[model samples]
Target chain A: MAEKIATREAYGETLRELGHRLDKIVVLDADLSTSTRTALFAEKFPLRFFNLGISEADMIGTAAGLAASGYIPFVSTFGVFATGRVYDQVRNSVAYTNLNVKIAASHTGLTVGEDGASHQTLEDIALMRVLPNMTVIVPADARQTACAVEAAVEHKGPVYLRLGRSKVPQVIPPGLPFEPGKAQILREGQDLAFVATGIMVGIALQAAEMLDQEGLQAAVINMHTIKPLDRELLAETARKTGAIVTAEEHSIIGGLGGAVAEALAEDYPVPLLRVGVKDVFGESGSPQALLDKFGLTADNLAAAGKRAFQKKKG
Target chain B: MPAISAATLEELRLKARQLRREIITMIYRAGSGHPGGALSVLDILVILYYKVMQIDPHNCRDPQRDRLVLSKGHACPALYAVLADRGFFPAHHLKTLRKLGSILQGHPDMRKTPGVEMSTGSLGQGLSAANGMALAARLEKARRRVYVILGDGEIQEGQIWEAALTAAHYRLDNVIAFLDYNGLQIDGWHRDVKSLAPIVEKWQSFGWHTLEVDGHDYASLLEAIRRAQMNKGAPTMIIAHTIKGKGVSFMENQINWHGRAPNEEEYTRALAELEN
Candidate 1:
C-alpha cells in the first residue's frame, strides 16, 4: 500500500536518524529552521545546529570552510535566496572546489503558495544542475525527500536537495528504497509516460489514473535526480511508451522538462510535451490558485499526456 | 636563545625583502598583478610562516595544522612569494605566475597551491569561512587555530560583518583575523572611496577582541598575534595599520600602485632602494 507523507516532515525525521549515525554531520539554517523543518535536527542535536540568521551567502561560505576542515555541513535555506542570491559564493566557494557541503533548499516551485514569485524559485534546478560536481535531487514527496536526504549524506561531494515547503500529498509507500540517479516507475503503461520531479510527481500520478479511466494507459516515473538524470530510464521509457510528457513545478526551460528533452533528442527521439511553468514569473496566490493559473494541475498533465500520445500517433 | 633576538628578526626581515623582490619580478613578468597590497603584506606573511604559524610545508594536509586564509586574495603575489620561499614549491615556478597551466593562478587556488587553506577572492567571504573552520575545530574538540588576513577596503563588504557577528556570538576563540589597514584600494584611498574609520571600535562593537598594531613593525605584529592567541572566548581582530606600498618609496600610500606593476625605471628605483 502506498503511504502518504509530506517531503518537509520526512526531511526533518530522516535528518534526525542521520544525525545519530554521523557525528560529523552538522546542520546550518538561515533563520528558516522551523519553516524548512531543519528545526527537527535542532531539537535532536542542539549543539550541532547553527542558526546563521538570514545571511545565505555567509551560510554557504561558512559551510564551505567547515567542509574544507572535514566536517560535513548541510546548509538549509529557501530556494530563492540559496541559489539566486548566493550564486557566486556557491560557484566559487563550494562547487568550484567541490566541497563536501549539502544545500537543502526548501520552498522550491510555485507550491510554496502565497509567498509568490519573489519566493518561488522556478529556476533553481537549472541553476544548480549546470554546475559541475553538483548532484541535484528533487525528491517526489516527503517519504522520498527523507530517503533522498539520507542518500545525499552518504554520497560524497556537493549535493543540492530541492524540497517543497507546503505539505504535499505523499504518493510513494513508506520504506521504499530511494536511489539518487535511478528513476522510480510508479505504474507501467504502454501508450505514454508522465516523467516528473518534486511536487509534479503527485500530479503525474493523478494524470496517469485519469488516463487509465479514458482507456489510454499512461506510465508515471519519478525522476528525483535532475543533474545525473536517469538517462537509461528515460531511454527505456521512451522506447516502451513511444511518447513522453515531462512535468515539473519549475520553468519549462533548463529544468526537468528540458533535461528529458535533451536526453531523448540525443539518444531516442520521441514526441514530448513539457508540462510546467511557462517562461514567466509567478504572482502572489494560494498554491492551488497558482497551479491552476500556471496550468500545472493534474488536468494539465493529463492533457499534456494526451497531446504527447497524439504527436506520437502522427 | 634570546627572547627577542635581533639576528633572528634580521633574518626574517631579509626573507621579507626577498619575498618582496620576487613579488616585483613575478608581477613584472606577468605584466599584471597588485603590487601595493602585496608589498604591504609581505612582512606579515614572512613573520607568520616563519615564526608565528604552527605549520609544516611538507605535510600541508595535516588535520591538526593551523590554517591561514589570505582573505585579501588579490595580494596573492606576496602569499605566492612567501609560500615559494618557504619551499611549498620550487622558487623558480614563480615565473609562470598568472600564466596558463601554472599552479600559481592570479588568485589563490587551494587545489592547485600547496599551502592555501581556502580559495578566496571575493571580499568579506573569507572571514566567514575562517569562522566555520574555527567552529568546526571546536565541534571536533580539536585544538587547531585559524588565521585570516583581510584588506582594509575588503571589510566594506557586508558579509564580513555577518561572519564577524556570528564568530562573536559563537565565541569562536580559535579564529584570529588581521585587517591590512593599508588605506588604499584599486580605485583610490579607502577613506576617500568608503570610510571604514573607527574600524577597531566597529570590530569591538561587533564583540570581537580588537587590537591595533603597526603592520610593518615585526615586533608589534608578533606581539598582537600572541595576545590574540591568549584570548579565551571571543574572536580576535587585529587592525594592522600599514602603508599601501610599504617598501617602495614612490609607491608608498599611492593609490595608483594598488594594482599597477612597476615600470622599468620605477622597478630599478624600487629594487635599488630595497637593496640599500
Candidate 2:
C-alpha cells in the first residue's frame, strides 16, 4: 500500500506545469477554480484563464468560442454541471462542430460523497460517450490523470476527461505511457476477466488478488478510455476468458459497464456481470460507506467475478 | 457620423428589398421555414454584408477578417440571401433553402455554409461565442471584430445574461451585437410573452454601450455600429426596432408568419409587393 492522492489534485499540478510550456492553452472554470484546481493554472497564466462565475452553459459556449478562434480551451467544472446541466451547449457548440475543447470534469461518481445525487454525476460517461466526435477518458490514479490531461491537449477534438474528488491509491506506476484509446492490462488470468475504470481499477486489481487465492485466475484490466474504446484489447480479453465482470463507480446502465457490454455483445458474447450503481440515485454518505452500500467494493467485485465464472461453467 | 450618401442608402434599400424577395421565394420553395423573422432581420444583414463588415468572399477564412454570427438562426434565410448576394456562394443556391443535402440548413451551420462564423440555432449562446472570438482577437492583438445578431424572443434564455456579464467583465470592445427587436415571436407578441422591455436599460446597466435605432433604416444601423466601435472597453448592444415581416404588405407585423412559408398565391402577392 502506498500513499494516496486525488486525481483532481494531479490534474491541477499537471495543468500548472503544462501552462508554462503551452501558450495556446487557455483554461476556463465556472467559479470552481479552487475546487477544480484550475486556480493553479489561473495563478500562473492570469491572462489566459477565464473564471466564468458559476454559469456552466455560458462557460461551455465561451470555451467553444475560444476554441473556434484557434485556442485550445480546457473547461473545468463539476461533472454534473459540465455534462447534465449544460448538455446542449456541449452537444451543439462543442461536439457538433468537433471543436478543440476539453471538458475536464471533477467530482464524478458516487465518491463525491456528502453532496449526494444532485452533485454526483453517475451518468456523465454515458452522456458524453454517446455524442459523436467526443473522446471519453477516466484516469485511474494521479499519474494517469496527468497523462490523460496532456494527451487531451495533444489530441485535437472534443474530449470529456472524468476526475475524482476522493484520494485513491496509486494503481499505475508513474510515467506509464498513455495512448488516447488504449486499455492497460494490469494483471493476467484465465478463468474470468475483470474490466474496471476510474477508481474501480484499483478495486478490480485488489479483487484479482482475492480471486487468485481461491484458485480463480481473473484478469484485471484498466479501461480508462471509454470512447474510441480499445476494442481490440477487449475483444482479445473476452475471447481468452469465457466469463467477464465489469466494475465502475458509475451507473451500470450507460457507464463503463455499458460500454464493455456493448463491445463484448458485438464482438464476442460472454457471460458477464456488471458491478456498479444499479440505476439508483446515490445518497449523502462517506465515500467508503457509499462504495460499500452501492456494491462498489473489492469484495463485491470478487463475488461478481465468481458469479460470472459459475454462470460460464453452468 | 460618416455621412452615408442618399444614393448609397437608396441602393442599400433596393438591395434589401431584393434580398427580402429572395427570402420570400426561398421560404416558399422550402415549404416549411420561418419567413417573418427572416424578413425582419433582412436589412441588418444586408447592411453588414454589403457595407459594414470587412470581409472578402475570396478570403473568408483569413484570420484578420470580421465575423458575423446569426444567433437567431431561424432567420437564416435572411443571412443566406445576403451571403449569396455577397458571392460567398451561387445565388441559385438560394432556391435550395432547407433542401436535403443543401448547404442551407434550417439553422445556421458554420461547417455547412460559407461565410458563417459560428453555427447557432439555439438561442442565448451566440453572445458567449462572440465573446470568445472577441477575446481571441484581443489576445492576438488583431483589429478584427465579431458581430452577432440575436432575436428579442431568444433573450428569454438565462445564458444571455451570463454572456452579457462576461463580455463586460472582459472588456470585449471588439464584439458588437444587434438585438433584433421585432415585436412578434413564434407564439405571439414578445410584449405579451416574456417582455424584455427596458431592454436597452438592462444592457446599459450590465455595463454595455447600448444604442437604439430603426433596424430597417440602413443609415441608422450603420451609424449605431459606428458609435459602438468608438465606445471602447465595453461590448455594444444595438437594439434595432423592426417589424416582423417588413417588405410584404400582408405578412407585416403578423405573428402567424413567424414560422410559416407563404402559399403560392401569397408568394406571388409578396413578390409583387416587394417589386413595387
Candidate 3:
C-alpha cells in the first residue's frame, strides 16, 4: 500500500512553509484549528492568525476585509460551516466583491464519517462552483494539495479549496506543478475513462489496475479543478475513450459528476456514468464502512466502468 | 469634543438639506429605491464625508484614507450623492442612478463605484469587515480608521451578533459603527415586528462602548463620534435615534414610503420643503 496523508494535514503544512515566503498571508479559523489543521500555521505566526471562535460568517466577512486591505487571507473551517452556514457571506462579501479570500474547507463528503449527514458536506462543490467569481479546487493527494495552496494564494479573487479528514494514497508526484483549470491524467487507456477528483483519484487508479487484468483498459484522469472544467481536455479524453465515469464522494446532483456532465452535454455528447452518492443523505459510520456502503471502492469503480461500457450511444 | 462654530454648524446643516434634495430627486428618477432609509441616514453620512474622513477625490485609492462600509446598502443613493459631491467622480453621474451600465449599483459595489470600501448590501456583515479593516490597520501599523453604517432591522440577522463578538474579541478600536435607528423596516415598525429595545445594553454587554444620541442633531452626532474616537479598547456603537423618512413631511415615520419612489407632486413638495 502507498503511503497516505490527509489533504487537510497537507494544507496546514503547506501554509506553514508558504507563510515564510509570503508575508501577506493571514489565517482565520472558526474554532476548528486543531481539526482543520490550521493550528500549524497559527503556531508559527501568532499575530497573523486570528481564531474567530465558531463564527463562520464573521470569519468569511473579516477575511474579505483583510483581502480588501491587501492581505491574502486563508479561512479554515469544516466544509458544512464554510459553505452552507456562510453561503451569503461567501457570495456577497467574498465572491461578489471579487476579493482574494481562500476558503480552505476541511472534512468534506461522506469520508467525514461518524459525524453523520449534518457535519458531512456532499454539496460544497455544488455550492462553491455556482458562484460567479469563485474558483473550486479538489486536490487528490497531499502533494497536490500543497500545489493547490500555492496556486490559490497566487491566483486573485475567491477560491474554495475542498479538503478531507481521512488520509488517502499519494498518487501525484511531489515535483509536478499544479495550476487551477488544468486537468491531470494519471493513466491512459482507450476502452473507458474514469474522471475522478479528491480521494476518488486514487480509487480510480486502483480501478484501472483491476480493469487491466480483465482485458479492459481504463484511463484515470484527475479533474481537480471543478469550476473551470478543462472542456478541451474533457472532450478529447471522452472522444478517445468513447465512454466516461465520473467519481466523487459527493452527491450526484451537482459535483464533479454534475460539472463533467454539464460540460460534456454542451460541448461533446458521450455515454457517461456518474459514480457518486445517489440522491440520498449519509449516516454515521466509520470511513471505510461508509466507503463500502456508498460503493466508493476500486471494485465499485471497476463495476461503474463496466456499466459505462454497456451504455452504448443508442 | 469642542463646540462647532456657528458658521460651520450652519454650513453643515445647509449642506445636509441639499443632499436630502439630491437623494429624493435621484430616487424619483430611478423610479424605485429605499427613500426612507436614505433620508434617515443622509445626515450621518454628511458629517463623515464633509468633516471627519481624510479622503482625496484625486487620490481615492490612498491606503491611509479612512474607510466606510455602508452595511445597510439600500441607503446607497445617499452615499452616491455624497461621493459625487466630494468629487469621487463627476457630479452628473448621480443622474444615472440604477440605470443599466451605471457605476451606481442598487447596492454599494466597490468594484463599480469609487471611494467605496467593501461592497455591501446584505445585512449583518459590515461589522466583521470593519473589524478586518481595523485589524489590517493594526497589522500594518497604520492609523487609518474604519467606519460602518448599519440599519436597526438588519441587526436581527444572527451574523450581526456573530460579528459583534468578533469586534470585541479582536479589540478593534479603530472600527466605529452607527446603527441608523429609524424604527421602521420594509415590513413595518421594528418594535412591532421584532424589538431590539435595550439595544444599547446589548452592545454594552458585547464589550463595546455604546452611546445613544439624536440622529439628526449635528452636535450630538459629532460628540458621539469624538467620544468613540477617544475610546481605546473596544469598537464603539452609536445608536442614532432617527425618524423614518425624516426630511419629507408625508414620508416622515411612514412605513409606506420605505421602498417607494416619490411621484411628481410628492417630488415637487419634497424639493420645496428642503429649499432654502
Q: lDDT winner among the candidates?
A: 3
- Which segments of model 3 are wrong by more than 4 Å? none
Please state the error at residue B90 of candidate 2 in Å: 2.3
TM-score of each: 0.96, 0.98, 0.99
**What TM-score applies to chain A of candidate 3?**
0.98
Cα lDDT tens digits, model 2, A55-125, are 99999999998899899999999999999999999999999878999999988999999999999999999
lDDT of 2 at A42: 93
TM-score of 3: 0.99
Name the candidate, 1 or 3, with the larger DockQ value: 3
Ranking by DockQ: 3, 2, 1
Model 1 pairs whose backbones collide = A6-A142, A7-A142
Candidate 2 Cα deviation (angstroms), residue A244? 1.2
Name the runs in model 1 displaced over 4 angstroms: A1-3, A173-176, B1-3, B263-269
lDDT of 3 at A18: 92
Q: Write the per-residue lDDT of candidate 1 for residues B175-238, one digit (tens) a residue.
A: 9988998888887877788999788889999999999999988888888888999999999998
What lDDT does the true structure give each of the candidates? 0.89, 0.92, 0.92
Ranking by TM-score: 3, 2, 1
